[model samples]
Target: MTASARPWVLALGLLTALRLVAAMMLPPAPDEAYYWIWGRALALSYYDHPPMVALWTAAGSGLLGDTALGLRLLGPLSVAVASVLLARAGNALFPASGAGYWAAALLNGTLLFSAGSVLMTPDTPLLVFWCAALWAWVQAHLRQDGRWWLVFGVLAGCALLSKYTAAFLGLGVLIWMIAAPRARHWFRDWRLWAGGILAVVVFSPVLVWNAQHDWVSLVKQGGRAGSVGTGSALRYLGELIGGQIGLATPIIFVLCVAGIAVACRRFWRGDAAAGLLAAATIPAALVFLWQSTGSRVQGNWPAILYPSACLAAAGYLSPRWHRWRRWGISVGLVLTAMVLLQAALAPLPLPRRSDPTLARLGGWQDFANRVEELRLERGASFVAAEEYGLASELALHLPRGTPVIALGDRWDLFNLPEPPPGGRGLLIRSTRRGEAEPLWPQSEPAGEVSRRREGIEAERYRIYNVTVIGDGPRKVALPSRR
Candidate 1:
């Protein structure tokens, strides 16, 4: 209601509106659609990530229905949460200051936060939970209020439930405690122990699910960060740093790294406020930095660091680099605007082999329409896709309750029951980077589906009529899909 709060209000409103429009106008990314389908049948955990994203999506679609707007509702909603929490976090880190405002600005201006506001990925909820926990941690440490510890525990657990990467949040807290001499009492504090117990309890469902499934999720996610390759360590590290730069706008990204270094120094000098910010980011950032040595890390893998990175950058970046801040904001806003337009209109003409965003946007509508026609014309009993992403995309768009299945390991994410043995299907293969051979031996290419963008061919899919010869029903209909 105050004048100062107006900027935050405006930022939140503009972001929410842009994200909502983008979410509705642009089709869901294949991964976003996969998450939405995952939401349809909510589970404690999933093959990909934990159940928090499922919970977030289910809440949105359950109330608003299965439309894109409904599926992506929570993403925009979280923007408001992230905005307010980052503000509070900024104030907590530096009392009676503009740190909060700058933090919120630095965060909202970047594609990391803007694109995430509509994408509905695990990072969506994880961002919300991470910022919330950071705020609570600052309050608990600064006020020495034991009650805030419980809040931190709950938020931390929720972050874990959102993604396994949040384990670094726990590590950060421990590092902060050990590194900060005065904070040693937390080790013996009963409130801390109670909070720890609460976090374990909150995260128990994921543990139970993994236990039932032979700990597959743990092994898979853990194995990703498993072995460190001695070769290409520098190259991987260089990419990780460059990727973070792109994720955060270039100038802001540089400031974020420097801010973290500054905060780490303050932590060593016994600054609790700086320590809270450093603890939230430094440990997680380092883990991913180390991860880059072993694997080809994605550009956004270190997105978890942005909450604290934004806050730290705000407090540190604003003191200097006024012109650089303008450049960063301009670049971020321009890039975001271009993306929104791309999502809405697919105006960009980039190579499909390189940047696939616009290409992904173009082909789906045509693919969906053609696939439906194939089902009716060819009398195909089921829709089979070569990859999990294709299966989910076709499944989500083709029919309300169509029997769409992925050929290989992609089937694990779906909650649908196994088919009743024998069936005939139309196999849709997007020849971008997949194998030419069909998973079923009894299948051959029947025809092709060409999807175009701006009157130019963007994707070519080979359609195959596949049959599983068996004693079951040779003429079975597709399952009544949900």
Candidate 2:
């Protein structure tokens, strides 16, 4: 590695450092909890996502145990890999000395760093695999090397295993080939189609699992997007663009589009690599814009676009912006500072800023512990929940025999073996009720047990301890306490 190569090393190091910083600071989201649960189970597929994320989660847990840092270690490690791949792909596209390094650096400062890099989720792993696949595809395209097609096949397969979102890449690439006269030869290549078969093989398990579950995952995700209409659609698109501004600075986003225009000319002149960046963005943006017409969209739905955008920005800026290197550095620093400040302000209160469904994240484990004490004192049979997310998290931490049951539709995430024995169950809610009627006539509330404070700090519904006084063998009596 020489002078130009040193920047690649520095960029990689910076990405890894940032990942470490975020892993140490950021808390896990509900999705992380769900995936962590998958890790604990070590299943082939999850109800919501494929097993790749579960593998990442398990790796984190195996190394760090079930702590925040443990859950996030793999996520940041993934960002490091994505950064390296981005650098290599950029180098392949441009003739500049350190173009790849600059491309990776530009990616480092965007919201991609925060969401895909810092916050560990299924997408984090998928992004890494996707970047790697794209890099391999570019190499194969440029060198006409048949063997790289097999590499692309394996990576594409892994990307699909990571997330269903990788379909966009195939679609985008296909369109790019059909539209470009010079690259039309890709259709005649046997290895290209062989790669598609490889992706199918890697993704088949999840496909089978979804089939077994009646494709519930697809229905759930589709319903989520379509459920929001008109007003929310407009709002979602606005936020989508807003998120893009934060993730890939407004200036960089603008420059990337211009870069795509310039890259298109090169592609027309048979520079196959130039089309890769534009192919990723143009089609994804079109789809995003189309979806925005009816349903609200998530900003990160098209997160796959970030890598290409980075490449585009590098292309647009290298010629003119590189001339003013000092000015570019100053501007880049200012933009990064502003974005970090915004992310900090955006989620200042942690989980509260994320999702309210989760029990006020603060002191939740303490609450879980208190419930445990009462359950043990009274020798409770099982723990029932009004919500699934909370029930799932509590189940993870609670004593093994203490079954957590979901009383509502949200509990669909958990697969219960059967109802608690004798139709009698212990209800867990955040309220004051000593005893109440159970769902079955045979079951009734026995006594109340719970922890209460001055006010609900995080809008966690009042947790209640209701004893179902019904016909069943008395394991232990609820203590006579207030």
Candidate 3:
């Protein structure tokens, strides 16, 4: 609001705008391309997530003419909006002190700024709406205003539509209710109920879509989680913890831990909202805890909790000690520098464009030429991979609706009920096999396909041609009836 504040906000905005410009031009991440297909098709649900990611990409493509910039424009734009809302929400939530600025700064420098809002993923949009919704709820609670609740309703609805992960917010809210007595008083408020109904209304499309498709969305998510062996829960948990450290940065994580401890001790006993904020992150934490038991967990799965993490940190650190204020800026700068360095080297190994290591590890565009070659040779009709990661990359390289499939991963592209009947299919695998080999071989092969062993850094993919048998005894019916 002040001139000093205006410049800080503007600087953040500028930084975001600059990053987005890069994102706009940067090649689509494999996952983004896969989701882009969903957007092109305009489905209610896909094998991976609700349709919101698809809808956002489709809308961007339609409006911006479907270039790489079109695909990623929404990334920075959402983060910018989220930054604004987070500042506003922090101010409203903690009006007396100047802690809100720190909250904004902390979020700007953390993983949320680096990944979600900048990556153009479904989580970016969800985070935007999630922050807005929380801000709206704070406004409504503080003022007892129906208008804020209405806005909150819409935001919650949109958040739900963006990703089912939004449901974790409900868990957070419920935890807040149980832990903070003051929040319990709002139970009889009509606005709260109305807001709930509105959220359901806004998120209804995903539910309806899921129902029509036999809840395949649920099945897909469950399968993904289960794919990680339950025995590796500790490794998964360790990765999650390490990821949080990287994502939140040590400074903010420490602040959040202090904030939570303070809230639990000084605030939770009396203030319900603070308690609610602390409670909201539990579901995600618990899910990670459960997931850790099975397989290596991704650090980003718990990304949704960072807002609360930051909020809690802000609350705890601000009141306890203003002495370390200068240190905060120094830490933020160091973390920001690290992130920028990573981004600068994003197109690693120089102009080679074929880093098999990065490609196998989620940087498929490193072999853009190979992907392009396959698309050109195969006529871009049917491309499938044994891994979703590869399939996702193909989705980006191949033309829209090229019918990319995931074989060995229990995600059968050909399993769809009405996928183009029989087309030439290109298979990219780590193992060598004729078309007759079972997609999911019971054991890891003696070694990966010979192509993967090639000296070409990006030539890890081995291609094979196969004809998809349609409507035979062996054919798995696509879920058209569902």
Better of 1 and 3 by lDDT: 1
Candidate 1 lDDT by residue in tens digits, 156-235: 99989999988877888898888788777888878887877888889999999999888899999889886666669888
Q: Write the per-residue lDDT of candidate 3 for residues 1-482, one digit (tens) a residue.
A: 78657877887777787676666645566677666656656655665677778777877777786566677777777777787777777777777665666676777667545544656677888888888887886777678676776788888889888887788776676666666677776677777778788988988877787787677777777676667674555666777787787676666666766776776665436876676566756667777777677776676667777676667667566545554444654575565654444443443443225432234323444454455565576574565565555565665655444466554433433224434556655656643234355463231222223222123343344566655654322322211100
RMSD of 1: 2.8
**Which candidate model has the greater TM-score, 1 or 3?**
1
Q: Which stretches of candidate 2 lie over 4 Å from their true place?
A: 222-233, 265-271, 322-363, 370-382, 397-403, 407-416, 422-456, 466-482
| Ten residues in sequence with the least summed lDDT for candidate 1 | 472-481
Give the winner by TM-score.
1
Write down the TM-score for model 3. Answer: 0.80
lDDT of candidate 2 over 166-274, digit per residue (tens):
8777887798788767678878889888888888898888788788878877677657645647576677678777877755666556666666777777777776667
Error of 3 at 220 (Å): 4.6
